[model samples]
Target chain A: MYLIITALAAAVATAFWYKNRLNDKLHLGALCLMYWGAALMWLVDCVAAIIAGEEEIIDTSLNAALLGICSVALGLAIWLILLLIRSRRNKSQATSINSH
Target chain B: MACFAAPLAEAVITTVLMKRFEKKEKMTDAPNESQAGIPWSRKLKWLNNLLWGGSALLALEHIWHGEIIPQFPFLTALKEPGGVLPMLGEIATVGVGMAAFVTLVWFFMIKIADARAKKAAVSGKTAETEPCI
Candidate 1:
């Protein structure tokens, strides 16, 4: 399920964020915010479906689970790309500071 | 079925607000979090990023389900005669709820950040000050 996958990503990001609180360079906090926001949205969706009797809570079919995994993978790939960009920016910033 | 549209709409409105704040920030200073109280635009940016990311994923999932299409009146639900009302109802309830919940969470984040900044200040690390000679 998208809910489980996204929530798991959020947990991992939250842990990393907690550990790296001293340094804001990684921007894991932002990553955590993104995933947690996703998880919350999915939660609301799941609840709404249940209340409406539209869908089951757990759709454990192979295709659905695979899709959820793919979505999470895509999300993480984007986060990694962002981290690389920020790190490069920070590096350039540090060089300018040193030159100054 | 078009529930994700709610947060996506919210994201558009927030993107506008964020751009306005960002322009103000640029006029004042760089987009630096090390600045006092962080920046309103930066704080708002957290919300914008979350909403945008979530909306993108939801939109993709919906598209995969063929609930959305790459044509006019993109939502398939809209194509059904007399489908407008039910789709609107879903958006009103689910979409609004998701947007409001995210906003509430953003408020909590702001509070936590403020508290952390205050603690750092108390520890003499948050601001630049001249030392006694």
Candidate 2:
């Protein structure tokens, strides 16, 4: 499950980077967010395993939910950021057009 | 039969819904304007429909087949209930996780599509708002 989450994270980050090549800043920022979420999931999974005293097997669902929450949060944040940027640009263009 | 059939049925439903959404998105982004047809909101509505349908399937499957709790020795000290509460909780958690994961994937798809559209919109410098606007 960790591998699944990692792979999904990688896929998402790659897609973001590829799609946003015109904006390297947004690409890196989104990638960092994904990686941070993945890293946090790994940390939580590892710590939970240690606390469980079950070194042989680790629970994947706990980490899965954590990662899911992180993904939703990051996705919403990205959507909001993009929307804000687009609206501001539109507003600025509208003002310029009006002035002209 | 809700155990095995439910998941497969849900998968079929999800596939149909996703394809419908894709079609809506395509039509919405087309150059030809046609507002008298299907509403544009259906593009995202189908995605939400998938999440709800998928969650229902996941919950039903988990309740019917999934284990209620972790196999921890300490937790096992508590008497297990033959009732439905344990299954409900487990299924609820799994369903929520599955739905959230799918929603995240849908968001990623939307972001990629939006980015591509934005790039296309800027490249030719031709205002193509007839369809989307």
Candidate 3:
């Protein structure tokens, strides 16, 4: 199970990384794949910890909360990075045009 | 301890990188995109830093309460299985966990940035500059 999750995460990450290089980018698909990868890893790890009898590895209620927060944070990070790149380019272009 | 240290260091490095990027943006003729010096992306760094810190706390809990310590020991605190110290060392494995978490965040950010940059470049917004007369 753990290996399956790891393999899935690795595959998705690799796909997105490759998609980034493609001329016709499939960003939304990449984003979905990335989240699925993360979710799978998290799920597998949590289950492994349970099987190992280290259920305390991540205190259940708190772990769930943290996972939610982490997901939101991940999304925010992605959103902001895209915005930054876009705005940076916009600003650069505006400045050039104004000066011209 | 070692587990938490790495993520914390990565956060610091990322924070420093963001600051440097901001300074460079300010020095250049970059358009102000109307959003002051602070980009929303910085929020992501802050969020990641918080998550790393939180995970470190979780790791500590596991170490303090987990079986590893009871499994092995330097000196036989408990003659049978062992002292908690040797088992506690397994907590160091949390470092690998932390790395995995951080990598996920880094990859997401990088992917997003790359996509945006590529989009801009393809739109010809970046490659062709209007005369800054």
The candidate that wins on DockQ is: 1
Number of clashing residue pairs, candidate 3: 10
Model 2 residue runs over 4 Å out of place are A1-100, B1-13, B19-83, B125-133
**lDDT, candidate 2, B33-102, per-residue tens:** 1323323344354344344333332333234233223454223213455544644453344333434445
Per-chain TM-score (chain B), model 2 = 0.42
Q: lDDT, candidate 1, residue B82?
A: 89
Model 1 ranges off by over 4 Å = A80-100, B29-36, B126-133
Candidate 1: give the clashing pairs. Answer: none
Lowest lDDT block of 10, candidate 1 chain A? A20-29
* Model 2 error, position B26 (Å): 9.8
Candidate 1 lDDT over A54-83, as tens digits, reads: 757867777777767776776777778888
Q: Which consecutive 10 residues in model 2 chain A have the weakest lDDT in total?
A: A36-45
Distance from true position, residue B30, model 1, in Å?
9.3
> Model 3: per-residue lDDT, tens digit, B1-133?
2234444555566667767766766778665332232243543444344344334333333354342254544123334455445434533454455545656765675555546545655565632221010
lDDT of each: 0.78, 0.45, 0.46
Q: Which has the higher TM-score value, candidate number 1 or candidate number 2?
A: 1
Which parts of model 3 are misplaced by more than 4 Å?
A1-100, B1-5, B28-91, B124-133
TM-score of each: 0.81, 0.32, 0.37
